[model samples]
Target: MSSDRLALITTDPAVLSGQAVIAGTRVPVSVVLDCLAAGMSPEEIVAEYLTLTSEGVQAAAVRGAAGP
Candidate 1:
């Protein structure tokens, strides 16, 4: 419900070489976007990646960052 998309994901040098990922998980933002781009639904993505949530996928699509 917030406009600040950055809050949905994080980037840390210790984590995936600072690649953007979901706030509390290692799932990369790019992965989520890739799923969507591949014609996968948010629900499907969430099912495939248990660490992901519908909200996170939405944020990833919007700000190129996965959900918390």
Candidate 2:
């Protein structure tokens, strides 16, 4: 995949006041990461947040694992 496709992180002033979020949603990347860390499955997350996908959840996990 291109880096852009793999990069789930994004920011836009018109979106969620520019918070870093998964591609197309107001859901902060950290919120997804926290849910995953709490042992919530991707399906569960999707069920709870329709804007999220399994890929998004996984990407959040990968990014979270890669600390700054």
Candidate 3:
């Protein structure tokens, strides 16, 4: 993953049972990916998940596209 991707997402056992979440927020990366898949724009995702910024959502999308 790119540094921007790494910086935008974080996984910690204490947080959401270690789900890869948007950095500093409980909103999981999967949620962002799912939102995008469901046709929600980055702005829409940010509206739904207030803690997430457009950049973070974009980063998550990029990572999801890149895959494991």
Candidate number with greatest TM-score: 3
True-vs-predicted CA distance for residue 63, candidate 3, Å: 1.7
Candidate 2 segments whose C-alpha is farther than 4 A from its true place: 1-5
User: Model 3 over residues 1-68: C-alpha lDDT tens digits?
Assistant: 46766678888999999988888789989999999999999999999999999888988987797784
Which candidate should be chosen as best, given lDDT against the real structure? 3
- Candidate 1 weakest ten by summed lDDT: 59-68
TM-score of 3: 0.89
How do the candidates rank by lDDT, highest first? 3, 1, 2
lDDT of the candidates, in the order given? 0.83, 0.79, 0.87
lDDT of 2 by residue, 1-68 (tens): 33544497778999888877888777888898788878888899999999988877776777676653
Instruction: For residue 48, give model 2's deviation from the true position in Å.
Output: 0.4
Steric clash pairs (candidate 1): 56-67, 60-65
**Distance from true position, residue 11, model 3, in Å?**
0.3
* Shift in Å, residue 38, candidate 3: 0.4
Question: Against the hidden reference, what TM-scores do the models get?
Answer: 0.85, 0.78, 0.89
